[model samples]
Target: MDIHAWQLWILAAIIAGSLEMALPGFVMLWFCVGAVVASLAAAVGLDINVQLALFTLISVTLFAASRTLFKKAFMRNASTVKTGVEAMVGQEAVVTESLVEGYGGTVRINGELWSARPLGGPVAEGERVIVEQVEGLKLWVRRPAASLEVPLKKKEGR
Candidate 1:
């Protein structure tokens, strides 16, 4: 029982397209395109070796071309609908605990408790701070410069 070259090429195309669904990002799409091209070559009576070489060349070229174009398109259409830690940036939250240098503290953002750090000063408990950045599950924070005040209790005690 021998399978025709056309049948092999069609099978490759179907498998490539199916794999695209399981592992998306347009990676397998170029292979599927190549397989289709190979199938057409087979229909035109091209030898199997030529068909294979053509498939490899076409797939590589298409993948490179699509990757460049996709990146450009993706960048142009990007949006900031924050999800996860990204959403915490620019949000205001009260320091639930003091953030000592080299130590972690906690803050509540969007009703969720998160590990936080003061940018460059001790953030006393109940001090309002704005999230400057998020690294992993931790939030970097600072008192908005305009709202900063000297701590009277600390100054008097020193």
Candidate 2:
């Protein structure tokens, strides 16, 4: 009726796995793998202290290895495509309201009027601007260079 060391190590692994699911940090699961290695050490009749040391070494090494894998699997790459409003950057927009330095205005980008601010000097209404950044519900814009500007035809009345 005596519980064996390997059985205890296996139980610890199961507990670690369950805790990983409940907390979900993508961290504790590495310890579960270490516990499995410890169970193998115990099955071979290794000393308790030796099993503990092996567990610690296995867990830390696996964690380090996983970080590189995670970077390749989850992190952005140079060829990655952006979606949503993030896709608006570098696009051209029209100022719907004049933007004074340090003050906010409105711009129409992709057919939507968004609160906007200029990165440098003020932008006048109906002027063309380029989207520089998108922060929260606001936009950061800049005037297109002179070479990029197209002269607007004047209305007969004004």
Best candidate according to lDDT: 2
Off by over 4 Å in 1: 1-32, 39-45, 63-65, 80-83, 98-106, 114-125, 133-140, 147-158
Give all TM-scores, in the order shown: 0.51, 0.58
- lDDT per residue, candidate 2, 21-130, as tens digits? 99956788999999999999999999999999999999999888888878788784648788878899999999999998888799998789999999989989999999
TM-score of predicted model 2?
A: 0.58
Show pairs that collide, candidate 2.
none
Candidate 1 has what TM-score?
0.51
At residue 9, candidate 2 shows an lDDT of: 91
Q: Local error of candidate 1 at 28, Å?
A: 6.3
> What local distance difference test score does each model get?
0.89, 0.92
Worst 10 residues of 2 by lDDT: 71-80
Using TM-score as the measure, the top candidate is 2
Quote the positional error of residue 148 for candidate 2 in Å.
Answer: 12
